[model samples]
Target chain A: MIDSIARPTAAIRARPVLGAASVVALFVALWMALIWSPPDAAMGNVVRILYVHVANAWLAYLAFVVVFLASIAYLWTKRPAFDAIAVASAEIGVLFTGLTLVLGSIWAKPTWGVWWSWEPRVVTTAVMFAMYVGYLLLRNLSNDLERRATRAAVLGIVLVVDVPIVHLSVTWMNALHQLPTVLRPDLSPTLDPRMLASLVAMTIAFTIVYAYLMTARVDIERRRQARIIEARA
Target chain B: MTIARIWRIAAREALAERGHPDGFVAAITFVATLILVESLAVGPLAAGQPPVAAALFWIAMAFAAILATTRSFDRELEDDAIDAILALPGGRDALYGGKVVALTALLALVALVGGLLSGVLLSLAIALPGHLALVLVAGVLGLPPVIVLFVTLALRLRARGALVPILALPVLVPQLVAATNGTAAAIVGDATGALGWTGLLIAFALVYSVLGLTIVPTALE
Candidate 1:
């Protein structure tokens, strides 16, 4: 059973296609964002950062949703494939989350005049980053694959559930304190057609990149599992 | 029968704690030390302010809860008694419930002692003691389910001591935020605000309690 399950599948065979498509999409997205998009009326060129930042943020969220679903599947079926998917998505989720934070910080320094803020979105994202980092750390605490997968899945579910509450608490905390709004510029800029096109293009590009990364990561996880099983056998 | 079993397990834990009070002692000491150290770091004038004191109080509670939960689970692991406990009918959920009950009671005591100490040491003049007590209770109640769940999940793993906090603390952020703000509001006589935050605390506790119950069985296996 282990031997049969470890055999490479069509999904692995298609990796190059995914990789090529992601590269092409990203180039198109870069062009659209850097040159095709119109500058914002209020913030001008600084608005370009949102194309990448928002895409990263969106993909980070998508990755966690995958983790959540894959975790549930892993728990229900006890399949190594599902576990691999969960862990792969979780790793990518953390990477994108970190990117989101750095990009957010860069965007904030110029816009909010501070590198960080206790604003609801910022605080919530930071907390989530820590939580998923913990998730990744938890994955390494067990030597047994099944044990590690079970524990990671459990934590993954818990962390995802906590996201909304974390967001709510931060928002309410800010609401009560009513931090100085003068520094926070209007985030919802009127999106011109070109700007919308760029944002959409970047989002699509990031999603493809996510797919390419996942395929490679899940392949690595499966190979690692197969090697472990081979050693035991 | 389930409730009785849960109570039995909790009572057993209480008796064990009465006999060996080390966990409770360590937790209290941790709370005291954290509060004192934070107060010193913040300086005398700033530490005495209501908001600062409230934040320090909850921060201490959060760490104290971690210490208490770790020690609680450590006992089960040391005796290798988890398998035996799980062998009993309906033991998994009961054990979780029992631990939550036992730990919540233990933490309530810690909160009482720590709260009074912070009140005096920080020179906080509480306008509403009852509301502040309610916040403390709700906040403490919000803690054990997550701690017990995560600690149990990480119980037999390597690097557990470090892993447990890293796993548990981030989940506890919302509760910590709500509790700290609630404490501040209660101290400053903002009854409505305190109640609002307390509501959030209760919601958090309920959510995690349900989640822990559903997940603990698989986690134990």
Candidate 2:
């Protein structure tokens, strides 16, 4: 058990920066989509920023899905690799959710005439952000990795409602925010084909980046864990 | 062990907690303080006519519910019942499920007596009689996630009462919103759009039941 976990450590070092290039590439692509892309009459150039904002929102869901699965995997398999994946995924998911909120807030300012609103989606996403932050806070305050993972895994799965609730609250709250006009409500892919093409490609690109990061982090965690075990021995 | 036997074991363990005087006092005090704090708002509430006093009342229910939820697992942890429950081999789920049901029942009973009194006294602030049934239903449905949460922590941390409130609140916000919205709707005779919010609570309960059964054993271990 110890030998194999230790093995992945050196493997990760030998191939450091595995995912950095692809992530950089994705970031550039998102920038191009936001800056160089054509602007619409209604929302102007500000709306184009949504490509990145919405993509991060989608990736928040993606990261959470990974966290949830990894949680179930850890509980069922009792594997530390699964715990590392869940924890890493949750951290990354929090970053994306935060970015979504910030960028979404910026977009809202120019468009909605206010800085913040109490609409269901806004409240729910705010809650989602808070939930992940709380997860990290709880994990940090715990002394043992095993206990942290156990508690965090249970939390990861149980809190899955945050995503769906955020999605639904956008449409239902009817406070200050309008329902989703493009991605969900219409489901008809309303953007210009060039933009639509870029959006899909951007999502695919991000998924690949997610994979690369997942493997690198898992391998790094394996090594760090192995070193701890060896030091204890 | 038989299903009935497992349930009995779980129920007895929960019911055995009657002697904890702090839980008894804390639950009542928490509810009373919230009502008193809320009553102080009657002047503005009447003056502003903010169109959502019932929502505010439900907010108190939510804040009140958290204290009661923590008491269940905190009591179990103090008594060392969690370790024994985990040792029972496939009994953790039974215990987990039974405890949530038991706790929700206990809280609803508290909510019924206390919430009714608050509703009557706070009537000038908000008339929410129609919200009572929905509030009770929402309370029962909304508590599982809260219960599973404290139970997970009570098993893992054992000594920390501080983190449960902080950790549970953000996650409970969605449930809290639903209960508040449903109660608000019920209070104003606007039950037409309340099902979805009520459903959110039901879904919260369902998620905890399944996930609690499956994950808590590993957590306890």
Residue pairs with clashing backbones, model 2: none
Clashes of each: 0, 0
Error of 2 at A150 (Å): 2.3
What docking class should model 1 receive? high
lDDT of 1 by residue, B5-93 (tens): 88988998898899999989999999999999999999968988888898898888888888988898788879887788899998998
Model 1, residue A2: displacement in angstroms?
2.4
Q: DockQ for all models, in order?
A: 0.80, 0.54
lDDT of 1 by residue, A24-94 (tens): 99999999999988887878899899899889978888899899999899899998998999999999999
Which candidate has the top score in TM-score?
A: 1
What value does the TM-score of chain B take for model 2? 0.80
Docking class of 2: medium
